[model samples]
Target: MQWGCMDFRLLTFGDLRLVDGKGSIVPFPEKGLLSICFLLTSSSTQKARAELAEFLWGDIPLDKALANLRQTLSRVKNRQDELGIELLLIDQATVSVNVRAFTNDLALLTAVSQTNPHTALEELLQLGRWDFLARTEVIGGSGRMWLRTQRDRIKTQMLTTLRDAISAMSEGADATVIKEAALRLFEAHPEDETVYQILGETYAGEPQLESARHIFESRRKYRWGELPVDPDPQTLSVARRLFERQRSVAPQLREQATPQLEIVPPVPRGPPKLVLLPPVNLASSHQTAVFLSSALLEDITVGLCVLKTVTMVAHYTAEKIALHLDRDAMLERYAINYVLDTRLNFDGSIYWLFAQLIYAGNDEVIWAERFSMEAQNLPRQHREIAQRIVASVASYIERNEFSRDYFERNPEAYRQYLLGQRHLKRLDLPDIRRARKAFQTALKENPYFSPALSGVARTYHLEWLVTAQGDARLLKLAEEEAGKAIATGQDIVGGYHQFGVAKLYQGAFDESIEAFELAETISPHYADVIADYADTLMHASKPGEALEKVERAIKLNPLSPDLYFWTAASANYSLQRYEDASAYIERMADPSQAARLAAASAAMAGDTRKAKALVRKVKETYPDFKIDTWLSIVPLREQWQKDQYREGLRRAGFD
Candidate 1:
């Protein structure tokens, strides 16, 4: 690192440098920079990495300290590069500027900014230039008191600068600087028309007089219009005198104020920010480990994402927070404007959920709700949970996203649908049968429950997967149930997703493709829909296109069901992207499923040992596994395709 001085002290990282008091460059890893900024503003010379990491990455494990450090260090470099400034390094452990090395404007100002008049006033006057980190004030770590304290100091100095500029003008010191300072003062005291009147009076003999009068009159009018009253008599008389002289500057001033006023219009507050915190796996059922987490987040985020003005933080960010940490600090750290956090409890017969949304600024509990749902209605119950949260947030904010009647008039049908959903998740024959009965009951209650209809289709879809007592009968039942669901839910994306799965089950490639394509348009982030589309497209002889859709799906929902990844790997295999196929096949949930896909992908990618090991793993899961027999049981798009894939595995030593 090198430090150079001309107008600023500069430190360079690589080719990049952060100049203290001059230049425009900054490093990447914004959060790291923010962390450093927090440290620098503190009174302590050093802060523990653990404390910093806990604050910044509250949800991340301790092992990620190095990764977080590297990220922050890179940002310091980027910031220096952006500003062409010298960077001061304290390394990663703690960030502080040496009192002897160089004086930082932020440091000097921070001293006086905290108290009435710091003894360093004379020194501060020299260093106080523009608003301290004016551009950066709008961004995050804005939640930190340090930035606010620093900005408060900067503005106070700005006021001092304005006074000095005005003083210099009166003493005939620097006419140009005085005018610039007068404008800045005008900005700071937006409600003060007196400054405008004084400025107009001072510039009366020059060409600037008209411009000054325009400023005076505009402020007077703004105060009057917003307040719906005339200015005070004393202020009005001064402004009236200025306005009379400033007639010529009216048009130019009007042009400037138009866009400025519009830019700051009040923001509409919509549904509260809802962050679905990690649901505890109380039963250790672990079967629903990924499913419960992914599905809950999916429903909540997707539901909240559609609303305008509701600031919902992404699911990944929230779950990253440790459960034991304070919610307020997390909200502040994440810059979350508002939060709707939830928790779940499951007993043998019933599931209960409790949720609340709160404002970060005041810790005000904005909205709260509790739900009790039976095991039989889990799917419908989850959907209701999503809808209730939305409805509650909507009522508080006084805005509507869904149709008002969507759930209000059909409570019974919604309940029955929830029962069906609860049953479908069971993934057993008895559960599927029970789910089918609940779905039928829900449809009987209200025929337009598209989500419940989808649930019924899903029940059939799972029954086929269980490969129960009668293959032909179960497959036919799934097709008919899916058809009934499609009849009701065709216009809804969930309808298409379920129906598409049904068609895929029956090997109806063309129909499945159409259903998934339509579903993808309604909600581009649905992993299941995109994966099914890839499958259908592969079957339709468009493997390349199929692979692209699945890749897009992967990007949209990174932690979707492993089954989705397996489907994508299969698509990649069809497209001869064997390495890419292997990359995705690695994420499969079920050991047996992982083995089959890994064996195929490993063979295609020429990993002989991996292929043999995967085949062995599959045999361990399914002892009756023979390459030919397993291929027959698993549904590949074509028999020849399956034979060719198995042959490649055999050649790679998957006996």
Candidate 2:
């Protein structure tokens, strides 16, 4: 190999792009480009002809594949001469790229290493425009496998580079770079708390305590509703102290400061702590009116607890201290960030209530409202008051934090949540077990955690469904977990949704619909709830309603899981729209799960050969999948609905 000055540059960060010295694109046929890119990115700059042939053309017969490889290689070689670049060093036994002949972006990035991380980071950021071969395609067999491997390798290297850069900053290199790196990590893993900790620590280390405190506070308020154990607790303490000192000093300087207000330090970490003070009875001392005030306070506390994004001091705790001290003293003693104070007045046949959400830190009114209701409507009035307060507090937190509910601050729980979701989404026996374990781990750390508990329940229900179990043990267990989730406030929407699934599978169609309605009321925009609700509707023989709900789910969650499409397909099949059902089934990511459904729909849609092929495929995986066994396990409530499905499968050759 002879070294020569060359103008061509191979950029392989996000995309497979080749730019000449003059920054002009050196276009090559897709085949030739793929061939050159493969060799350029491979180890030792070389690969055997046999290996190349197997990877690039393995889907075809050996002789034809080899001929195709030869043609591609010839085109690649011709491109070198055409562009006046020494792009390849070809031989009878193997082909290699002459690394010294051109400047490659990946090589330049790697050469600098991450020791000079700022430059390396800048390069990495620029290279992130595309994956290994963003717009390129590798059709079938070993070629697709090789492409995946290369893409994963490059992505791994980028992530490693980010970690290295953050490490360099932590070691006292460039503190400013920490923010940029942390934000980038946030972009990559928005739900991950570790990056926010890193960024927070970097700010704290600079004695920029306000920024550090803000990061953690905002993360808690807008993202996680709480953060993980602080990574640098000592540094975090120092930052909190500095913030507290500033708050203390600022209030002292206010000449007109209220003597009744006490300047209390904020909670060091976690979501805002709120306490609903016992309502003051303004009506004449009637036992019933006093009892109603206490009951109202309890009701409000329970409602706030359901919005687990905020911490609510228990009613017992509030009762013991709420009336004994001034609001500021209560804030200081209990470290309460907000106080919900209420006043109740009772006149004949009418109940009047005054309420306000106050910021304990400054005694500022965050929200205030008054309610009047007939004495008989006390229960409804209490619910309305609780809902209003919860919504107001949520909005207040969002306003202070300057973000939507995005990050999951509990790193450990969130990690487990992600792991469990991955396994649950796969919907297999072993994966369901893994998902259960992961969810269990999450609950172990935060026992009252709702999402993890919901996951555990979901996994149990999935296991029961997948195994086609006649025993209701798993279903019962799933129900228990869903109740625990709702009790713990995991996600009001998800908890009800899981509960609905348990009810649906148990053939309690009306109760299941009621649960689903509750979930929909809580989170109207939640796609998973909509999708699952659609599934329940389909089982209840309401195919039209099911179709509408499933379509709404897909619209809400444009990139929803394959199960959403499968539900849509099933709903369409139940509605006897075979052509539409076939179209939706084809869109499913894992069509094998719906193989029987697809085959039936195809047969009814007049695609006999495709239907026959799909039936054969289903038989290969499910040898014992008899129509009678399937019908027995399916949750369809109506005999007519079951018969409709039975006839379709019968048409597709399944007896």
**Which prediction has the highest lDDT against the true structure?**
2
- Give the residue spans of candidate 1 off by over 4 A: 1-275, 278-339, 343-354, 358-413, 426-430, 468-473, 623-644, 652-655
Per-residue lDDT of model 2, residues 480-596, tens digit only = 787677655523456677888998998878757867776665555456777899999999999999999988876544445678889999999988899999889788767888999
Error of 1 at 547 (Å): 3.5
Per-residue lDDT tens digits for candidate 1, residues 449-519, read 76666777777778778763336566655555554554443335566677677667667565566567556
| Alpha carbon deviation, residue 417, candidate 2 (Å) | 3.9
Q: Rate the local accuracy (lDDT) of all candidates.
A: 0.55, 0.66
